[model samples]
Target: MTTLTTKLIQQSDARGSALAVISDDLSLTWRELCDFSLRCSTMLRDKGIEKGDRVALLCSNRPAFLVAWFGLANIGAVTVSLNTGLVGEGLRYSVTQCSAKAVMIERAILDAKRADLEPVLEGRTVIVFDGEQDLFAVLSGLAADAPYEGLGSDPLSIIYTSGTTGLPKGVLNCHEAFLASGRWMSRYLKITEADRIMVFLPLFHTNPQMYAVMSALEVGCTLVIRPKFSVSNFFDDARRFDCTMFTYVGTVLSMLTSRIKTPDRNHKLTRCVGGGCPAEVWRAMQERFGIDPHELYGMTEVGGWVTGNSAENYRFGSCGKARPDVDVQVFDPQDNPVPAGTPGEIVVRPKAPFTILLGYWDNPKATWESSRNFWFHTGDAGTLDQDGYLYFLGRLKEIIRRGGENISPFEIETALLDHPDIADAAVVAVPDPIFGEEIKAVVVAKRDFPPQDVRHFLEGRVAQFMLPRYVQFVDEIPRTETQKIQRRQLQENDRGMIDLQGVEEHA
Candidate 1:
């Protein structure tokens, strides 16, 4: 009963003239957004896109992105959200792997990667936005009405995982799950129509999409969209838009703390809802900006949040208690429940069906492997206190969390090995004060290679976040008997082996 279509319709009918979305160039009311979405949906249906078809959306955080997203959902079509930072092989692999029938991309992205996208765009519908000929022009004369026959359990979006170990897997999320997430956030965060939510994170990720965008739509609140996160203008933007609440991830809090204190820092902002709020920075933010930081723990696979710590009932280093509808427990490797305060894998079971991820798209092996024992196993190590408060310890998977982005060591190693001068490589996480973790690469090279040269080689091959911060060349890399790279050993031994500051200086 709580499908996205219903949420939009209800809001438009009730608050037709309320401001719903705001960006630098455009602002739309609830009625306008609902009407535009209907026209967009009709446009897609005219192009032969039917129920259950996959349509890829590759654009930055903008009004066009939201229009396309809602339009696809209106007609029961699945959307494959592509990260705007992706390029070349990574971009091609995502579209091809999902078997996207059509792609809607921004003109700037298309122009920059026309050569890389040519092969993937062949034999598929490609619609360009933010250009001379945009989606607005195409839907100018289209009817502002479309049939909504979607059920709550139908698939809504396919978000690709952050390829931490190998290739990225598409995580399928349903309408029911998304609606449940927004409802929970709306109640727990106490968000109301008067709240102005600032959304600076990428729209492709679940954090910004669910916590910021969807939650705003559900409550008929004004959503202030940003192209991307900006450290220098973060507080300025919030103050400029009179934002009441904002979401964050990674080192956004830490970066803000490092800035010089200003008198205008204390603005209309009152509440902060996000994960990865380090304990030190968490305290600093509240003291500096007069805002309470509510840290929570969840992932893309879980469909929404699992645990959250609010200002009223928060522990310094805890992620708070699990929701009433979710069964969250810490279990050992053998699947037995671990004692309180013991670190183990965090697993979850939703009380209602279709309130969590349906499964990984096109990867039954991963779906079955993760959801074994009737509980979806989260690849995160954490502990629950006696009071039911969750404390995140670390990642079970060998992925690096750099500034809130997941960087896969295997992906970096594979790219490093592509260089003729490098014979072997192993990537590991190094502790950092601001970013939480920075990447370090230990390589067995054929000859001496400058760190800058290696970075230049990986510029277009991988995302900017995946690039290594420190490079240490050695004669050989440690390996197991089965010829597996001993990453844990490398991580432990390299603590004092390389001068990270010197490497940065030279690079």
Candidate 2:
């Protein structure tokens, strides 16, 4: 089996002279990157980490993170990436859940920000990269060319799910599966050495890390890393790096369009790819930015993207066709495949060269539950168009039932996002006296805009009952570390804040 280590070798052979990764002030050729990763791998080994061990990494998006990822994999170690944004019990839960053997974190996060997490690091060895007490000072200088033992089929990385429903579940991605997903992306995305990819999303997420980072490395493409997304300076950074493409989420697209400064699309960037872009947002963004944008549907549990819109056959409001060697079907509650244009649960079956996850780490029941009927059930609702374009509706569990009427939060949230004053919106079901459940919207309005403005805008667009009965304005929508809006968290908050009175009168 060809492992990710082999992929790096292939890229190095194909374009040894080409730049593989770029940061604000650094650039690494394929050979140099391999050398760095090898040295880092040896350093990790000297620290008692070996093949099949779980090493938790908590740091910002930097060259070191990528080095650690592939370096650990080089020696057959499984990397567990924790979201540094997580605080208190939530962060601690992820550390304990993974049963991590060692943790490497940035001291700024441990010492300055959340000192409480230090207790969890009491027994475990802590390596604070680039801190006052630097980890490298204690260790001997390691050689770059460490013997690479091929550990194919062994676990390479364990990504924790965003925990939309509950506690985050660790999804194990083996070396074979990780490479398979990367190859599929490289072939489908048409990545090449000439391409300079911009990655603003966190590497902890599957889409950006796999599609943006791994796909580029697989094809010898240059990766221009952004520590995080910044709407104000995104275009400037893209221009500086001469980036040909970038990965995005729906929130990033919305933030770009909300800005007064429009981006020029004539140079460099051909397209931006990611998932959850609303139809209207796409149109407005294309007009404002002059760049064609594509959407992809993926989950961490599945390694990477299962479907994506590409240049050859682009479709609006669709997450593209099923990937090669992957089967995507919309199944009913009974596991029967529904015809095109009917909404159902999305499920996937892997073919040759596509690595399906072995199981959820330490959760056999969930692993079985997600893989029923020889298919991996992706808990998401989608409908396939006649052209085989998959249109994501919403999460199956997130569906709101009011007075026996089922409502999709995606529909209502999209409607609210269309309002000019509304910066962001999330719809969730709240407990109601008579209806059993009612629609409540949490909104983040643009500066100088009021909640009444949003309510008035939605008055004519949707049915009276479909309107949000209660609207709470927040400074920002709470997002997972991946920038995915946590609608479930909003629902929990609405339980305490929503007002029961004042239903919209029928027009």
Candidate 3:
């Protein structure tokens, strides 16, 4: 009952009538969830899917997704949660990469990408949910009900995350890790069974899986699931379920603050938890919406969250203080520890068991390299203050070295986002003969915004060295489902740029 493998059954027996999850308008109690999950496990086991089997799950935020996810875990199989936004080679790459024994997809997605998924789906056991099979009845006809053998350290899921370069690597995480993170997060957020947490973020991402899905089970709370993030519906959704807390990435807040005509300052939400929240967005959330944003730093490599910001010990601009369960440090290019407040590569090692991921699936080289010097090198640029608070700069590779100065694209992007007309912004390092790397800012604005005005807006706000030499107006900015700007893609993009130096010289 300690492990997530058996927590479902325990919750069922102890809180059978307690509301477990809500999707759209339908709700399920703990008993119903346990029953449904067991059915999924039975059906899969009946189909020869035993322990260690890999199953690709490409579905949206719904009840069926949860059934398949938990069902896979119940039998000790690994669930490969594929991003629903993937198409063509990206979709095929993840399915084949994991060597998934089966694929549980929504009918809607299967129909749309059948051509791209045909090769991998040809011989695999494909279970399309959302009307394909009556899950409640699938196991009614079966159940040899022998003793279930599962371990907490057994991998519960393999989530695929793309790095700054190369193909995506599969991060193999275990039940103990998920269970531990849930408990840590519950305590970090002060979550209780009475706190109804809203999850509009995709479950494929680690935020929802660890913070929302697993946390709910850890504390026996309610989860209100929405299909996807909606700016217009956010105000009502928060109040609709009377949700006390919600999970967020910075993009969600930016969208709500910008797109919504009037920010929902009167919602019942007290706090939100997640990372990638810039200082501007963090303060804006507090002033405009009355929600205290808890921005933590995390990656799939070292479980869910390494450091957290909370009411007890909090910092406005920093990601937060290191969790009591992990040792967080910053290292220089030579992997040596730097002085406090000195920007360097963020690294971590777990203080508790199973907090770090098992390893990259089938990639020993990556596994060994990531855990170099016996520490999980996060590859992110950040610093630790003397008080032990972590300040997250952008990715190390994305830092623009201009005239011997290292400039953070994240800093420039934050300043750009503050502009009245700019809707979205991403700053990337561009090649230059003189300084080796110049700055380029790709902006998505509300209307026709000139590049000079954009440059003028940043006059005194940022240093002259950090100001972008090239500016481009685009309709939209490329982002992953988790709201991370695809910086590698942006760095590779050199099209339609307006050279500010030439424009200034001509004027």
Q: Which one wins on lDDT?
A: 3
lDDT comparing candidate 1 with the true structure = 0.81
lDDT of each: 0.81, 0.78, 0.85
lDDT of 1 by residue, 1-507 (tens): 556878898889988899998888878899878888889999889888888999999888888888888899998999999887778898899999999999988989899889989988989999778732367777778997555867899999999887434788999999988887787787778889999999887888888888887788778999998887787887788888899988887556655765535534567998788876656567777777877788898888887687887545678768888877799999999999999988788999998878789899999999999998999999888889999999875567776889998666755665675676876677888888999998888877678756666677888988988887777777777753113366766777754345545666775
TM-scores, all candidates, are 0.80, 0.92, 0.96
Task: Provide backbone clash counts, one per model.
Answer: 0, 0, 0
Q: Clashing pairs in model 2?
A: none
Point out the higher-scoring one by lDDT: 2 or 3: 3
Worst 10 residues of 3 by lDDT: 139-148
Please give the range of 10 consecutive residues that has the lowest summed lDDT in model 2.
Answer: 131-140
Cα lDDT for residue 408, model 2?
81
Give me the displacement of residue 261 in model 1, in angstroms: 3.7
Candidate 2 structure quality by residue, lDDT tens digits, 47-70: 888778888888777776787787
Per-residue CA lDDT of model 3 for 1-507, tens digit only, reads 245647777778888899999877579898888777777777888778888999999988887788778888888889999999899999999999899999988888899999999977887999876542565556567652332467777888899885646899999999888888888888888898899999988888898999888889888889898888888788788888889989987588777767654556778899999877777778878888889998899888788888998678888988888878889999998889999989999999988888879999989999999888988998899989999999989888788899899999988888898898999999998889999998999999888867888789998989988888999887888887667788878878778889998988888
Better of 1 and 3 by lDDT: 3
